[model samples]
Target: MAVRPDPIPAAQAAGTSLEEELAAVAASSLDQLRPRFRALFRVPVPDCLSRDMVARLIVHRLQEQRLGKLDRSLAEQVDRLGRGQESRRRFKAGTVLVREHDGVMHEVMVVPDGFLWNGGTFASLSIIAKRITGTSWNGPRFFGLRPVLKKHAPEAAVVVDDADA
Candidate 1:
């Protein structure tokens, strides 16, 4: 008979710091992680998942337990962003966006007021994209921040002859 490892609650009884627990999880091997994963998740670790993935999931769960999970609205927003359902993309200050257009490389830095490009501050990415391409362009799409939308071709009309009917 094989011995079962202690669950996360029992493991936490050791009173280790969150960072220490996280580090331990990061250093643990696949075999070591399986029982911990089972204990924390209350389910068998899927065989299809790699060791790295299992470790990440375990870490996330630990963090959630230690420092509460995201609120419902914030979690929903994150899920929407991940699924590309959110239209507006927010960039933190100091973020740098780069794009290549017509053999020229353009770099834009996100600022508190707006965006900085070529020593000038602009209100939006569209303005920067227009300046670069000499045409109106969706800034996020131009800079590859957003996915390209494909235009569907119109369906052909089918005609039926009364004689055939």
Candidate 2:
């Protein structure tokens, strides 16, 4: 088995001050970046970035190292919102969401405005879901879809307690 060397170079790891670290990252070359990326992320660095991107990445890593890594949920939400894309989701307009209630099959069409169920256009899936079930329900959850998890939604933001605020 091949043993990996200490991820950070000895010079950088030897208690170098933050100012020195920032300067080093600013001056870093591709050759210098591989081990630094490994040291920080504990993973091999991907080769796809341009030289300029690596420098920008180094600055970002340095900030994280000094302050703290972003919260995992927050980071994921930012990543989702940043791309401005739905990334080819499995369902879209004209797709059908179906549910069975009390031996009856209910089909809902994915419309641009909302779901179409029982020949009526409703504003939200939840409303259609309730109409089908005769009870309040989370529309997406009722249809066997992956519920929009609180962490997955930036709009379902994390709220601190009044005391925490």
Candidate 3:
């Protein structure tokens, strides 16, 4: 079998800044992008992909290499959304979500384990919502993470007199 060429050039391997590499990718032509795409993705460039798309994929890979990939849970959530599946709202650790109910403002902080509310660490938002509302409620909906579905009204029946008919 023939040997595959290195995806990253020597200049890039030798500590090139992300901006410089991205600029180079942006300036490269289709022919130039093919090998880079193959190297980065470990597969031949698809015939359907445009030069801009290839460049973007390469840029994303490069960024992932330098910065790091998305968190596993976040990536799964994104995939679920992409597949048109329902997914729970995800918040980064230390993010504060706020909602107002009964003229009182309530704040919840996202923690690594779960959520922080009212000086207690809870596993789910629904519990906090229940504490605040005194009734069982979907935590995400109560906190505005999920949309509240509206009930549809029934169609009105028509009444016609025999003479009119």
Candidate 4:
């Protein structure tokens, strides 16, 4: 693998210190300056993203260096939020995830490495989801453990459950 040069080394640029440069970046219009970011980082800023995204990325890095890193729990929470909040309630060893299918409520117990369902340990909820539905599905969504983003509410999911009777 080729060693990549640092994008913006503080030592390379003499006039402005890292703080000063960061301040300028914070104040600059992210949408307007496609060339400036490219010149500084030697990589083009993607046009699809807003300027705030670029500025926030830089600011976050700078603050991270100044303030060290977030706590592990906090970091995990952030990661969870970024990944669509699947299994928000950090499941402990015996926590159970229940979902009703057809007319039966299938119970999945959270284990150390995976989940226990019907006396079997599975690696992922996706495997269980497929087993239950006999079709492909985003496991988190299938279990109603993931937040739905679109206009439709998660409650609107169509379940062909005959057990209501």
Task: Give the TM-score of each candidate.
Answer: 0.49, 0.41, 0.56, 0.43
TM value for model 3: 0.56
Residues forming the 10-long window of minimal summed lDDT in candidate 2: 156-165
> 117-155 in candidate 2: lDDT tens per residue?
899899887898678768897766666553465654312
- Positional deviation of 58 in candidate 3, in angstroms? 0.8
Candidate no. 4 TM-score: 0.43
What candidate 1 gets wrong by more than 4 Å, as runs, is 1-10, 87-165
Candidates in order have lDDT scores of 0.77, 0.66, 0.77, 0.68
Name the regions of candidate 2 deviating beyond 4 angstroms: 1-76, 79-90, 147-165
Q: Which candidate gets the maximum lDDT versus the true structure?
A: 1
Q: Is candidate 1 or candidate 4 better by lDDT?
A: 1
* Number of backbone-clashing residue pairs for each candidate, in the order shown: 0, 0, 0, 0
- The parts of candidate 4 lying over 4 Å away from their true place are 1-68, 71-89, 149-165
Candidates ranked, most accurate by TM-score first: 3, 1, 4, 2
Candidate with more favorable, higher TM-score: 2 or 3:
3
Q: Residues 117-146, candidate 1, lDDT per residue (tens digit)?
A: 999999998999899888898787777776
Judging by lDDT, tell me the better candidate of 2 and 4: 4
